[model samples]
Target: MNRRLFTAAGLALFATASLAAPALADSLDQIKASKTIRIAVDLGSPPFGMNDASMQPTGSDVESAKLLAADLGYKLDLVQVTSPNRVPFLLTGKTDLVMASFSISEERKKVIDFSEPYGVIQIIIAAPKSVTIKDLNDIVGKRVATTRGSTNDKEVTTQAPQADMVRYDDDATLITALISGQVNILASSPQTMAAINARRPQDPLEVKVVVKTNPYAIGIRKGDDALRAVVDEWVKTNLRNGKLNAIYTKYNGVGLPAEMLK
Candidate 1:
């Protein structure tokens, strides 16, 4: 080789070796060493995640995160955040994992790796007590409300092109719109519907499952094997121990599937 080629080759090897060096501890190891496992918790989504009068987080997602941390031998650190911010929290190292009841999607999977599903539920259409709608066909040209930026909005738009969709910033806003007759139907994940049912049993709204959504996954920054593997293992263990089923029963008021029960 020429002299210029030889020098370039030497520089390339030096940079490659330096770049391949590993960190002091991988994400999982660091969490274990620190005895702290930070999880993204959703304070808005009910049944799966929410806060009580004390403003402390509790629900299926919170319980799942606690068990995951216990399996990893660390104390769970609940980092409360909104739906839109959950993935960002993981990417920015603000949280170790997202157990915030976020749904899995093909687009999201490309950016962040998700664990095997801890749970899955379809989005349902909730009609007001007076609406005579039996299905999507009945809602033609009617105003529908969905949580803004949720998969429910995307799914409903695809299924009901003629229906008008009004977007709300959160679950509360969506429910308010439906109950107030501002919108004829509220579309959302079953978790949200379950939460609403639990909160208002007397004047219960009817839920018709329209779309069976993919499972909810705990998100980790992509290519973070150390953390992903640990979380995956934790999910398996939780499923086997009936921890997840217990969580679902306790907070969601519904029993989980045998498959998720592991």
Candidate 2:
């Protein structure tokens, strides 16, 4: 009655327990043999998995992916995808793993397995100086911009029902609205916020983080423990050797929390 044996026998009853462990390793080994690791990502979310000005992948998550691929003796192949498509890419075998600042969700876990967290996420609010909004309540009856289908959009809508939630199609549009003073506030992922803010040195529009923190991780398909275990252990060694912290501090505030490292 081994779980692996049950899954191999095609019994769907214990699908979760049986299939999860073996799928991960099979994917990783296939990549190793091919000498190429296909990683799904968001090239638009700066400082996390975005492409640099050179169009090469550069950011906390991307850099971590490079190391992870190298550790597995494979070259990393980056595939640009939106927030909406990351999970699908992995589950379809079109992507070996997703490192696009993919957030861990309970519902997602039912469909996709996730490695231990490799990064952190925080919701930040940006507004023109004219608005003296210090918190979520200050934006009542005002327009706020966030990427459509983003968790931040849901958070803002839940918190300020009186506020008009303007859901933009992408993070770029949300940033444009905030900078042009088209919206009272821009609520977006902190990773994108930091990269955009870093470029606007003289701009008066300021960003303030105003929400709970969350962790990020690579998303593997639900039955893939082999690849998941490799990614999880790779992150640990990088953080222990200070390479991981160096990458995050290069862009974001600092490395993952000490507890997260553990």
Candidate 3:
């Protein structure tokens, strides 16, 4: 090729590459400059995130966010989000991080990055002490209630297909269905089960079997390596210093599970 033509082609390629490349934003620097970190939390999920008596956000996730902000020398701006909207908010730049009891899953990993697990929760099949349910097989042919579209619902449907499954719109309704005798067994998070037991201590429900194990982690927008690294380091430090356990126990009434310590 002629020198002139070669030079022209090189220029064109460079311009195209520059135009096609996404404009990368330094999320960590942005947060540092703004002096605030916006984190999304699910106010509806107790123990993880929920409203306190004063109707303000409070829970394990909330406390974790606070600690992260404090450690990073930034103010925390919590954005209330529902379970379904957590990722959307982060992807859309509405939040810097997500700590909504978000469990690390293969499906979610495709869209967003996750930090090391900060906590773990079990989805258990709970029933009145009088009723016996040792495993999935024990629940066969029995009425079971779970929140629609939850991991618990999916686990029950997949593992105990023989069980008569009833889906409710929310955790409160599912717990109600179980307590009201509408269902023989309830599949829910241990946190929700604890709340139920606290509210109705006389009924005395016990976890029959754990159907699913969920490890909670902070969700970061995909490709935000700086922010992800910072979060991962912060989580590791907290886990090592026992702050994570204190936060978990503060909300869930128990220490961090051994399986989640790593």
Residue-wise lDDT of candidate 2 within 1-262, one digit each (tens)? 1112122223232244323222334786788688899987787777776767787778777777787877778888888787765655565567888888777766666667788777788776776566687877877787778889777887777877787888889877777766565765677765555545565555645565566677788887755677778888887887778787787777685456777655
Better of 2 and 3 by lDDT: 3
What digit string (tens of lDDT, one per residue) describes model 3 on residues 11-92? 2212221111234477898998899999999988887888889998898999999999999999999999987667656766
State each model's CA lDDT, in order. Answer: 0.71, 0.71, 0.79
RMSD value for candidate 3: 9.4
Cα lDDT tens digits, model 1, 1-262, are 1011111232222222212112233577778678898888887777778788897777789878887777777888889888766655665577878887777876566456898888876777876476677788877787778888777888888999888888999888776665555665677865566555555666566765455556788988766787888778878877888878788778765566666774
Clash count (model 3, backbone only): 0
Prediction 3 global C-alpha lDDT: 0.79
TM-score of predicted structure 3: 0.83
Give the TM-score of each candidate: 0.72, 0.71, 0.83
Can you rank all candidates by lDDT, best first? 3, 1, 2
User: Scored by Cα lDDT, where does model 2 land?
Assistant: 0.71
lDDT of 1 at 5: 10
Better of 1 and 3 by TM-score: 3
